[model samples]
Target: MLPSGTFVLGGAASGKSAWAESFCESSDLTLNYLATGQARDAEMDQRIKIHKDRRNDRWQTIEAPFDLAPALAALDGDSIVLIDCATMWLSNHMLAETDLAAAQDDLLLALQSCAAKWVMVSNEVGHGVVPDNALARQFRDAQGRLNIALAAHADLAVLVTAGLPLTLKGTLP
Candidate 1:
């Protein structure tokens, strides 16, 4: 059986979201997708469309670009949520100039108290070269911290590289 929470970590185009989606689909519970990405430009719009095309009628998508706690709280034990992912969620918060610590705290609390099983997808940003700008550096630092926290809180943590999953914390179901 899948655990209460799973943290899926990977680099860009590492197939983490696809793996997570498959994981959730294997579960008998109702599937809920908590999308955190926003299409602010043409490239992003195309990306969103591609993701949307991959999911069928079985997945009920909730768009929470900035705030996710409320949508996460609304799920019940019969549901399995795939938050794809934390990287975009953090970016949204950072761009909005929100308090990162408080926002992260709220997210963690909500995930902890939520009744439904959940899988969170996050990018492994620290593997890349150090960014040159202040804002980029800040985002990298924040993403690293968030990933650490999520991994600590999750019952199962998996790292996806080149579409392969390596268990980091718990046994894969």
Candidate 2:
């Protein structure tokens, strides 16, 4: 059985999203996709399309590139939301010069109070070499903090590597 909250962490192309999606699909709740990615370029557009193509009509896609709290708040207990890739969401806020601390607080609060089951997918960027620039380093630090918060809040926390899941917190359902 899927828990109320699950945090899925992985590197790029680690199959974390696929694993998260499959976990949600196993549940009986209505699937809700809270997409945080924006198509800023051709490659990004194709990436978004691929994600969309993977999800069928059963998923109710909600495009939330900047503000996710509203969409997350609207879900009911009968829904299971997949917040695909929080890395992009964080980047969107960072690039926009938004108050990241405030934004992260709001997101955590929303997730805490949400009535629906949720599986958040985030990139595990801390496993790589140190970034050469300030911005990259800042993003890495922020993502690490965010992932820690999410994992602390989640009932089940998993790290996906080489398309395999390794439970970090709770038992895998």
Per-prediction backbone clash count: 0, 0
Q: Which ten-residue region of model 1 has the weakest summed lDDT?
A: 125-134
TM for every model, in the order presented, reads: 0.98, 0.98
- Candidate 2 residue spans exceeding 4 A from truth: none
Regions more than 4 Å wrong, model 1? none
Q: What is the per-residue lDDT of model 1 for residues 1-173, given as tens digits with 9 covering 90 to 100?
A: 89999999999999999999999999889999999999999999998898899997999999999878899899999999999989999999999999999999999999999999999999998876888898999999999999999999999999999999999999999
Task: Kindly list the per-residue Cα lDDT of model 2 for residues 18-111, writing each as its tens digit.
Answer: 9999999988899999999999999999999989999878899999999888898999999999999789999999999999899999998999
Query: Global lDDT of each model?
Result: 0.94, 0.93
Whole-model lDDT for model 2 versus the true structure? 0.93
